[model samples]
Target: MIHEHEWQQWQQQSANHAATAAFLLLDVQTNLTMLETLQAALDKIRANPAAEPYSLSGNSYFIQLQPHRVLIEELYGDDYAEPVTLSLDDFGDALAYWHTQI
Candidate 1:
């Protein structure tokens, strides 16, 4: 279940961008509880990776790199068995930089 604060945020964003998809960017190591909450939230909306249209839920996904192993999972949509992982420490900054260029 989504918390009251998160629900309100989702509602506000949905209302503000009716035609655009909302994405949830979170730090995987911020907190264990928060990570679990995010995982549950994403699981609720996850889609089959093999389905047509190949869409994700709410435009949210997770990326993690540990040692030589890179893990990628669609937090709210379809995901492939293997995820494309890159070397990056600050996910938010990378996303923001990409957004500016795009």
Candidate 2:
């Protein structure tokens, strides 16, 4: 359930040849602040799957918090279409690692 993805390198910059986006996976890591926020959001969703699906907005990402997963319609450097189902335990593992990272 740790979703794996490959980024498409567009040699030709053209919208006509654009590819459908892939949804966000739980393992990506970067800015510490954002990572913490995402982890918190994940915790909330897992704690109360019944309270969703709601939205979390920021300068770059816009996530749809579902029962057990998040839909990243506008991740800064990613493209997403169908929602990616997640394995919470794996995601938590990533988050744990993220703590020791930036």
Candidate 3:
């Protein structure tokens, strides 16, 4: 299991990435890279504006040698949250749902 400090580090790094819109070093999987995920998320944000009816949106960032994935919720009013989990499906669904609330 990953230590709590890792989560804190990830949170800080994520905040930095969100601000700079730059690629971040995340744990990678056999098929996915963290940088790739961040890029995809950036693309999604660009494509979907935070307007009424489409406020729910987020990005799934991965890490290497770890089972859990990070769910970054881009909520309305500039209030965002990152909840880490081991299930990709759950993160994806939750992000989709969150986007609708915005």
Candidate 4:
């Protein structure tokens, strides 16, 4: 589970980056607990090599990394009402940096 401090830091990073949404990409290799999966996901994101982006229903994006997946949603609402396609490179860079801060 994410500690209070970690959550606070994550919120700060999200605010700094102006991120609309964030999701954890759990590792599927091991039968890990929720806390462990969360931690592993965070670690992998920090060292993420590359990510593949897939469009999902309802203006959502799924970022896949092997056995893990990060879903970024609400990309085309309110703050971002216009249709905008964020580059994979940009997303990866932002995600990596955001994970590092957390």
Task: Please report, in order, the local distance difference test score of every candidate based on alpha carbons.
Answer: 0.34, 0.48, 0.33, 0.38
Give the C-alpha miss distance for residue 47 in model 1, angstroms. Answer: 36
Least accurate 10 contiguous residues by lDDT in model 2: 15-24
Separately for all candidates shown, the number of backbone clashes (residues 3 or more apart, or on different chains) is 1, 4, 10, 0
Superposed by TM-score, candidate 4 places the C-alpha of residue 3 at a distance from the truth, in angstroms, of: 23
Position 73, candidate 4: lDDT: 41
CA lDDT, candidate 4, residue 88: 37
Q: What is the clash tally of candidate 1?
A: 1
Clashing pairs in 3: 27-63, 27-64, 28-63, 28-64, 55-99, 55-102, 56-98, 56-99, 56-100, 57-99
lDDT for 90 in candidate 4 is: 42
The best-first sequence of candidates by lDDT reads 2, 4, 1, 3
Candidate 2 regions with alpha-carbon error over 4 angstroms: 1-29, 54-63, 71-83
- For residues 1-102, could you state the per-residue lDDT of candidate 1 as single tens digits? 334444445334432221111233333323445444434433332333232222233324444433322234445545343344432222222333324332
Judged by TM-score relative to the true structure, which candidate is superior, 3 or 4? 4
Candidate 3 — which residues are off by over 4 angstroms? 1-84
Model 2: per-residue Cα lDDT over 33-101, one tens digit each: 766776787788789878757565655445565786545444455555433333455445545554554
Comparing 2 with 3 on TM-score, the higher-scoring candidate is 2
TM-score of each: 0.24, 0.47, 0.23, 0.29
